[model samples]
Target: MTRSSNAPLSVVLAGGGSAGHVSPLLAIAHAIKATVPEAAIVAVGTKDGLETRLVPAAGFELAFIDRIPFPRRPSLDLLKLPMRMSRAIATAKSILRDANADVLVGVGGYVCTPMYLAAKSLGVPIVIHEANTKAGLANKVGARYTTFVGTAFAATQIRHAHLVGMPMRKAVATLDRAAERAAARERLGLDADRPTLIVTGGSLGALRINKAVAASLEALAAAGIQTLHITGKGKAVETASGELLTAPLYQQREYVDGMEDVYAAADLLLCRSGAGTVSEVAAVGLPAVFVPLPIGNGEQARNAAELVAAGAALLVDDASLDAAWIAENVIPLCKDDLRLATMGESAKHLGIRDAAESMAAMVLAASGK
Candidate 1:
């Protein structure tokens, strides 16, 4: 294990529940290390979710707290929320004392509520990073005590919110497009001359997007467009395809670890409009057809609208996502080089690649480091 200097400044990162929250936390942690080489960093999250595996892989110590999902409707879980929250706060106090953290950063989730509260009680500085266009329930409550607020969306509900944008990992944000495209296609054994379409449904994959693309496969192939599909865990490309168009035209996998390659090799993308997805697409300058996940009060749809208004992408409502519409609207964009190039250029202009560094600087200032 690597050790920092005695009396080194310490920070505790608290968040989880999805990759959307955890990935940005990881990016800020990386930026902190780069900017303040002597700083000590640790993570706080539940035992469940991707954080259990991801935090350790990123070479940071992780402290697990009690799991708490925000109650959608009042129930036994809601009744137990107060008790669980008390216990989680106590756990956070113990972890904070052990790590000797001088400041706490909440990345937005139920796990963050207790940690932020504990930090407030201890008189340690607290900061929050909100990734949604509208504030999430956890962040909204935590914002009252937070010293600084940062967000991917420019106009969020947080009172002191700053438009920092979402922070992507250094590897993905700084990938060389020309080199990555060549290497990624070579690795996937795809044709260099053909226009390629890359489709993904985020980390867990979207059933709606998957099914629509599967139904439109014949039409896409007929238009001479090859594809690279990341199907998550639910569906498989082998099961979706019979025997035709196997080689040099189609590549499918449950997940693509090489996202840089996926972005580089694709002429266009069909994806969900989550904060992380939108930010990455903007940073990479890719033309995309966004199908927002229709949940809650249509927050994803709102996010998609922001990009479409900026000419960065095209939005397709989840209710209207059929094979015919997919073929008609999305296939043409892939085939039309001039339109594709224009959209890609507009998308790239929306990226704020320095967001992580800006957020880290705020954390440092708040900590009086």
Candidate 2:
């Protein structure tokens, strides 16, 4: 049952819709291919999802399937739901068969559901990775078909789940922040000795976090702490008039392409507590103040709970995050070197740096390779 190094096993990773799902899919795929260069790696996604751009960019073949959203309430879309799902499943089954996939990996999204069902019908080994603390619908259903479920968070409520951590890209998982600090700081025009904090709301931006943090730049500057504020997309940088707006101490951007370098230079992070964010921060051992998004299944809060409990991070309510709160809590933490260092160490201890390799091993085992 073993494949030689020259003829590696094939893997089809199914998940899309958002970066959260696609990120881990690529990470695992990258891990598999890196370990076995001859492996044929393919990504299953819809034409409209983020995967269309991301999968191919990562050097994997992108296979298309029609997106099938399970309609919630009764409507025209609901009436069409069954047919849509059937088509998607048929498309997935065809993709699986054509690829001669040895294993189908689901990363828990709407796109994954169809692939999971198709994999089961085709008698292909199925492996699932759940990133959130609360299991998504796709993972919940996929779990029943196999016991080889991997989870980012230890407490993620997925049946047959084992803690394999979030599979992050090699650039992130193997980063040596301290070693890269000088060059990383220089890249951002930041002083290596100055306290640096990174405030991000996870790509789309958080209006409240932007406003609150933007308002506190003066206090942060006065405390000798510089900040890299990722104002999300299209948000105006609303710092106080005059010098503060153009100060080198406060850098603002809509997005950062080189996030690993940013993580390397940062001393503290103020951001939302999404599963991927939590895992990435923990992997880098960055001390953070997590602000869970007000909406959703309360999963964001649950995602940060273990880290907070481990003294690695602090969680703040969305409603309570204001300029005054940042001054009171965040600014002081920036000045406290010992506290940040201790928290960073604690966070690193809880992180799983080898998750990509571990998850790849799981996939190979399940495939009986």
- Cα lDDT tens digits, model 1, 191-272, are 8878889999888888888777777888888889898888887566445345322434666788888677888888898998
Q: Model 2 clash tally?
A: 0
Residue pair clashes in candidate 1: none
Tens digits of per-residue lDDT, candidate 2, 82-134, equal: 88999999988988887788999999888888999999999999999999999
TM-score between model 1 and native: 0.94
Query: Which 10-residue span in candidate 1 carries the lowest summed lDDT?
Result: 239-248
Question: Pairs clashing in candidate 2?
Answer: none
lDDT of 2 at 364: 92
**Residue 79 in candidate 2 has what lDDT?**
92
